[model samples]
Target chain A: MTKPASSHQTLNDAGEFAESIPHEKLVRSRTAQAMLWVLLIAAVLFAPALLYPVFVMQLLCFALFACAFNLLIGFTGLLSFGHAAFFGGAAYICGHAVKVWGLPPLLGILLGGVFAAALGYVVGSLAIRRQGIYFAMITLALAQIVYFLALQLPFTGGENGLQGIPRGTLFGLDLNNPLPMYYFVAAIFLAGFLIIYRTIHSPFGQVLQAIRENEPRARSLGYNVDRFKLIAFVLSASLAGVAGSTKAIVFQFASLTDAHWQMSGEVILMTLIGGMGTIFGPVVGSVVIITLQHYLADIGSWVQVVIGAIFIVSVLLFRRGVVGELARMLKISSV
Target chain B: MLKLLLAQGMLGLNNGVFYAMMSLGLAVIFGLLNVVNFAHGALYMLGAFVALILYSYVGLWFGMSGFHIGFWPALILTPIIVGGFGILIERFLLRWLYKFDPIYSLLLTFGVTLVLQGLFVNIFSASGTPYPGMPDALKGVVNLGFMMFPKFRLFAIVFSLIVCLIVWYVIERTKVGALLRAGTENPELVKAFGVNVPLMVTLTFGFGTGLAGLAGVLAAPIYSVSPLMGADLIIIIFAVVVIGGMGSIMGAVVSGIALGLIEGVTKVFYAPAANTVIFFLMVVVLLVRPSGLFGREG
Candidate 1:
């Protein structure tokens, strides 16, 4: 086994080379992400019969969740183990709004996103006080508290869960059918994905990336490191909430499983398996894992074992994941 | 009120034993290897299940079985077996990730947990297996006039204390202990001393994992051997580790018992919401002291 080298060696020594690159040129170069999103839209619009809308919807939600997760881990150099609080917490609120408050699906989704953002602000504010492993543990502890709250909350229906939620009208358009619902989910997912893409390409994204590469130097450069870290954390969590709320609408249910720590782990797995820091890797990962789940459902409990084995193999052999390594092989920097 | 407090304290002591064993292992692993060992819970679950299997299939008596092996043997054997598995893990999967991102270790161990839990579900099928306590030696209820408590509960408390002292003596007093401490600070210097740092890391992981296994063995009779028995418990122990400060063994032990009793008292007074009070305390503690109650400031 080779000795562990300092992280300084792996980073490019020639710094700020990409700092002056134009935004338009950067956007122009993302042909891969643009093409993938266009293809996804087309698939949603025309390929109704070829895919199970529910399955596709699930993939989109998880993909978005994974991407949101990557925002912290890949860009900010923070690994949060408590993302379930934002994701699942938002789902519960959205589900409750739609089912009980009788709100429109769009408004419900926004409400869910807002709730998660609020939670994200609180958790991120405190968690950012620590670095590395402590941050992960703090997030985890907070998420566990959310899980307990979900269990006891009357609106959550406890272990039985809040089920049979109506898809309701999407701004007066019925979304009860699978096709319309698929379109709605696809549109939301694409919008969220593009927002992430734009954020990653913008000046803010570069600063965050620099922080991930080296915090002390960024601090020396007069950056407000704490504020930047908190912003990244809250943004990642809010996006995860959007994904979770969308999932609740598609599945028409929200349960205790959403808040469980395992769900948080699953999101991380999706991100890692896809490619960290890559634009569309999480989407691909969600597709692969969701597809695997569909086919492997018959195996029941063994699925956990198989996923576990994949995780070990991925960390041991394919550390960069499918898209991260593939992007490198093709010399594509971002996507 | 005094009697209620005493009862809560006793229950807290019982719960503290579990916290000490599990969190002690986690601290050791984190200090030496800087890995959280997410699979610690799985290994603990495995120990309980192993004891259950031994009792059922091997006719190894512990509680209900005609032949009584008692808790002592189970404790020793469980850790030994669990520690052996931990050694294998350190040698194979965990060894490779020492140079990589710490998150990789977390992911790998999380996967290992899934596999272990899945395997148990496949074999045991969700329905819990029985785990009767030791022989009639400690079966009866002990009346303290104030509140009647089970003799087994008292035994569990005492046994864990004894184990904690022994482990503390070995880790805090021995010459090997000094070397282990030094290894945590600077493995390169320790390696120069010809102590074989890699071997020390492996042994530390094994020893830590073994503590978790021992906790499982003790817990078997207290709680049924189920697939999910250790999953939630480990999360609470993480809270304990965070509260105790991850670097100090003594802190882990003291905080574990203290928190457990605090939880127990919460159960007695605010029974409706006792389940989450420990977590609430953790959040408050984080706000007040992010490094934990016992952790040294950076």
Candidate 2:
């Protein structure tokens, strides 16, 4: 991918200049990375037995969703408030494909990701033209259009949503059973997590971070900033779609709730509470939030009040979030 | 077809008034504070609820049978109360955020919105509470050859236009408006010239929120007062702001009305697309002019 030596001398100098700085790495050492992997594997293997399989599956879906969201907001410095459109839109598409067209489960989920990537391309192209707040507003407005479509489209089943999506067998393994379904979801989550981790460590990801830190400088270095951003947006959106499709398969339904703006807000809350820019923050955040929602279900509207309170507190007092705080306390430069 | 068009156009204009007012508030606040007020919708709902409570519960507590504060008093009082609350919010919550990224303020206001809406929902329930009808002065309809229009809706359109024009003239023509404009561009420079920039920022927030409150009171008679009313309308107004480019007062007003009319026309052509037509317009506008129709590129 390197250009000719003469043509890219200035860009190479810029890249070298960036690398010269003592950058704070996300994981301090290989030992930390290995420990984290071991812990994650242990949690995945043991958590389902300790908790309900369905709950673990639900948590995995949201964890993947939050990680995808973090890839944009945390790593790329693009805060898309319309991520639910990708997540929920894919859910409906996958649900319909499997339930009606009788596609294989894996293929249905892949189709969902492909559709979301296409949507991300369309939305990111339009949105990346605007800077900061306008980009957020534009994405939100576009997502609202998606919401309206979901509400009006015949295939989505309107307000009631597409119900009774069958969890078709994957390679003769009965996904209808909770144990198999849970393992399937766990595997998907791990794959999605690895993809995000790999992307963040890749050369493309370094370019994205450079663009985020200093767009004009990155532009002057001959990097096509918009192209990088679009690619990141597509990757983030498709991963979120995978999460959504998995959730639909696990639950056997796709509802308007998934597409709602509130769902968008909830994802933001998750990222914030878990810690923005941290690798494991979204996973931890999703677990905390989903668990809170489960326990607070009986409190009605008060749940919203509590969540709002948490948001305010986090923004005002604990901006680092739970994982961010832990990383700080441990004197780690990054999580 | 002409008659139907006229009727729909009138309805569109009525909706346009609310759109213009709310978007004007947003633009003003954004220009001055550099923060998008997500709680704007919740504050609008609060305005209607305040008016409702003053008319119903407060009157009842006073042991005056049917002694309501009425529309005239509400038009003046509701904004003052809501604006005052906004000032407090600015003083305690938002002042510290000016140094941070704009996104933090957006999240802060969103949190405030959720809290306010949630509390209101808990207290008042999700369903709407209807406001009493307009005064006897605006109780009837007027008829033209082509179409008949509701007197209340006509009054709303005219009144909102008057308010919008007054705001525009104040901000665009007056000396204080000059200072406000200067402060928005360079607060430090204005402060160097002995302007209380912080106070100006706070008052600007209050005034913008007050305008929202006024719109809410005005909306109460047409749509039932509910916690959810602002949430639904605010998204549409955001689209209006996007189309207008949030930098110019006239842009917000003109785009608000134009988008409302376009949405109305869409309703006539295809009912399902009406809810989404404005967003489609926004996409088209972004493609053609990324900085919006009147906005300056940052």
Candidate 3:
């Protein structure tokens, strides 16, 4: 019963997060971790040359979104099926701000994040009243409201969606070109990832992890559990918004597709398949899924079935997911 | 305005009937197994499809185009078939997930929902087919004192209300219901008493899903049976489940119908907000009583 590691990796995966319980041998050493990050950056920098920039950017956007989602489900122990409202809602906001309001690209995206944060606050406050499945349901229903507003709102262009959003100038750099746009996205994605990493390591993140592991224990310790959850929810939602806004700028259009429940499910799938709380899991998940979507685009709804099947497989047999399994097999801290 | 109110209220009540049936199933499943049946809507959709295929396409592909099952037979058969499917789901997929977080079961069912919805979309296209025909017994409109309504619609509303009542009575009154409640409270204790708790759980899930199927059969003629129909309805049902709190049977029924009527009446006065009124009501309910209207605080 006594293993070198305190807890089993698969069990940790079952708990809906990653990393360790108490002390564990799974944490990759700092030097190796830093080297891994550097290598990842190098690969990413050259990724456009090797593959399509558009495709790479798409992966990055979703990767960021998944990571944003992970902050709640993995770290905070809150599962939200309503993240699409923020993702798609902000896509529209950022799209409108840049295209119609004539704001700078950076500002528009920032506005989108702010909008998501506000939306997140309202949704999170209401959702935090309930826990577990009820929490997920509340967020979902609230997101549906937002979706309805998006559909009926005058500026969203209804079914056609807000379209042809310009990739406006950022400090005189033309984002109309893919290269400038790539770096801009890469920077935001990097910032988003680092923010997540820092939050996880921070004391506040420790409380969140504690809350995830045991809410009552955390509450008994006199930490305002709901407040912590609300903050985490808002944070997750805003980052998701930032990702959505970034995606809108890259794609130069915002549509109802982003706000749909399917988009929310997609983010959940990415995080789950990537290994939830693992640092690089969502990135890996986004890559595999987006690549699959790209290649299998012609098949239409069959792709959804395939994705659903993958989800079922991942939950049943591969609960540790691709990256989670890899990390467990290697016994290196999950990437 | 009163006439419009009466008509919309009737429409709302019809919508609420589906919500009540669907949420009732969800509540029953959730209360016992602790798993939210995300596939409830899809199962509802499947029920309608079962009725559709049996009524029209039962041997159409096999050179027996004229040999179609009738509505009455489908109404009887669809629930049994869909419930059997639910039993299979519980035995194979859901059984393995009980030890993990309840959320995983939700995710698994969600995956099932997506698979079902996707497959249906691929095969049937997104556009829905009608239920083909209603038997002469349920066709035509009935003139209420103030307004006229479809005979089938009224039958559906009343039938579902009866079904909801029976389920409520069964769970609240009967010995089998006691076994279920006992299992929910402590499966081990019930097992110690020599009852099969796992089997009970499976049956509970099956019965719950059977209700969903029954609702689908009831709904087929009222609305076009489509692949995506359940997807949207399921969200509102979630709101219903939240507001009613899955722990209370009456809460599910009352809130489901009430919210539907409210949404319908809203359409009469403020058409734009009708779709989202239930959601807003959910937020208010969560704020006022986080445990739901009839739910005990966790």
Best TM-score among the predictions, by candidate number: 3
How would the docking of model 2 be graded? Answer: medium
lDDT (tens digit, per residue) of candidate 2 on A98-137: 9999998898899999999999999999999887877788
Cα TM-score of candidate 3? 0.96
Q: Rate the local accuracy (lDDT) of all candidates.
A: 0.83, 0.87, 0.88
The iRMS of the candidates, in order, is 4.0, 7.7, 5.5
Higher-scoring candidate on DockQ, 1 or 2: 1
lDDT of 3 by residue, B173-250 (tens): 999888888887888999999998888999999999999999999989989999988898889999998888877889
Model 3 C-alpha lDDT per residue in residues A1-335, reported as the tens digit of each score: 01111122234435565434434453454555687689778877889999999899998999999999999987887889999999999999999999998999999999999999999999999998887788888888999998998899999999999989999888899998989999999999999999999999999999998787767667899999888998998899999999999999999999899999889899999989988877778888888899999999999779999999998888898776787888778666763
Using alpha carbons, what is the TM-score of model 2? 0.95
Comparing 2 with 3 on DockQ, the higher-scoring candidate is 3
**TM-score of every model versus the real structure:** 0.94, 0.95, 0.96
In candidate 1 the C-alpha lDDT for residue B135 amounts to 54
DockQ of each: 0.52, 0.50, 0.57
Angstrom error of the Cα, residue A173, model 2: value is 1.4
Which is the leading candidate under DockQ?
3
Which tens-of-lDDT digit does each residue in B139-167 have in candidate 1?
87899788999888888888888888788
Order of all candidates by DockQ, from best down to worst? 3, 1, 2
Interface RMSD for candidate 3 relative to the native interface: 5.5
User: Which portions of model 3 show Cα errors greater than 4 Å?
Assistant: A1-28
RMSD of each: 3.3, 4.4, 3.7
- Residue pairs with colliding backbones in model 1 are none
